[model samples]
Target: MSVTKKVILITGGSSGIGKAVGIYLSQKGYIVYGTTRNVANYSNFIHFPLLTLDVTKTDTIKKAVNDLIAKEGRIDVLVNNAGVGITGPVEEIPDNEICNHFETNYFGAIKVMKGVLPQMRKQKTGLIINVTSIAGYMGLPFRGVYSASKAALEVTTEAIRMEVMSFGIKVANLAPGDFATNIAGGRYHAPVIEGSDYQKNYQMSLDLMDAHVDDGGDPKEVGIIIEKIIQTPNPRIHYKVGAFMQKFSVFLKRILPDKTYEKLLLNHYKL
Candidate 1:
């Protein structure tokens, strides 16, 4: 592949936002490498080269990073986008599911950073963009697990920005609102058990969640925002991308009274 202004590594790049980012950046002339859990599965389908990297597995992370650096000499950007979606009433969600959710969405992202930060530090310049979500800004009704996991990443990125600034590495969190992607199909939804207190509300949320994704904006919009962030000289600590109301929800939570905001959420979810 021909080189460009930057070499970007995007995890979970095989599909959804990750795939969109790879395609957009590659078209814009950036050398882009996307990672998937299994490269063989996407060999015939992907537009760009994909590396085998499972964020939950340290060995795979190390191999993917090493292989990239060995080929590209240095990595100028790392987009920690590999993550899975989980949604359910916090009370009913199984412990294993929660653990697995954090394993991929939160811990997996951190490990990916650990794999690439060393190379970035050596180069003395790099950008790490952690893809979070607008839902992270508030505790959504039944999406408690999903909100918490993304929120964790957002908070961690804030601290990481400070710690790595001296090393000339910039860390930022890009929280996208609902985007049209295959994420709905892959999400972990805790069983809507009969006779449970949350049965009705949980089912309503699950349906709403899927509907939102189906009606969400194009995934490439995220790539557009990411490209802008890459072009920026000193990118901000946090960025949001999505529809008017979805992003506005975040701002609303900040300015509105606590109970007022809770009421607004309750009304939206039809609880």
Candidate 2:
């Protein structure tokens, strides 16, 4: 590994914010590798190497991390960005789908961290940036499952950061707002079944969510923030990048009463 250029591994880098960040880092001369479940689909990918990784599977996670270590000799940074989205009323969402959302967004990120920590410990210095969401700050209407999954990672990141501090490993969560990504298309949504109690409200929230993503900011800005965070000698445990109202909503939650916040959210979603 080149002393001046760090090796970065970003999971779920095939598209969206992950791809944006990976490409930005690679363009600036960092040695970068992005991961996707199916590599054959990206045979001609030119931005940086896209390795085979399926965060849902432990075997694939180990292989990707080990192979990168073998080739690079050290893994300096890991952006645990692989995750899926689920939308619908919490009660209406199927149990399996809720489990699957956590499987990839929560457990999968943990597995990847487990795979890389050994090498980072050996090096005595490394950084892991877990990509969470601004939504994780609060329970959003129709996005409850996705919110919970990211929130789980957020709290876990806080706990693990302390556990590994003595080893010289720094962990942080990057919570991004909508970023004009393909997440909406890939997101799982419970059918808007007619006459169901949640049918009308769920549809309203779903449409609002789609519009937010469609009007999201450039994802490369997140890459820029990642670069800054990597440069900081000691990075904070939490970082958020998004529109003013989106970030402000977090502040509101802290100061307002519980029901007050709930009312505000209900109003925003027009429920």
Q: Which candidate number would show the highest lDDT if scored against the true structure?
A: 2
How many clashing residue pairs appear in each of the predictions shown?
0, 0
Q: Please, what are the lDDT tens digits per residue for candidate 2 over residues 217-238?
A: 9999899999888888899999
Q: Cα deviation in Å at residue 90, candidate 2?
A: 1.1
* Ten contiguous residues with the weakest lDDT in model 1: 1-10
TM-score of each: 0.98, 0.98
- Candidate 1 displacement at residue 54 in angstroms: 0.5
Looking at model 1, the pairs that clash are none
Off by over 4 Å in 1: 1-3
Colliding residue pairs in candidate 2: none
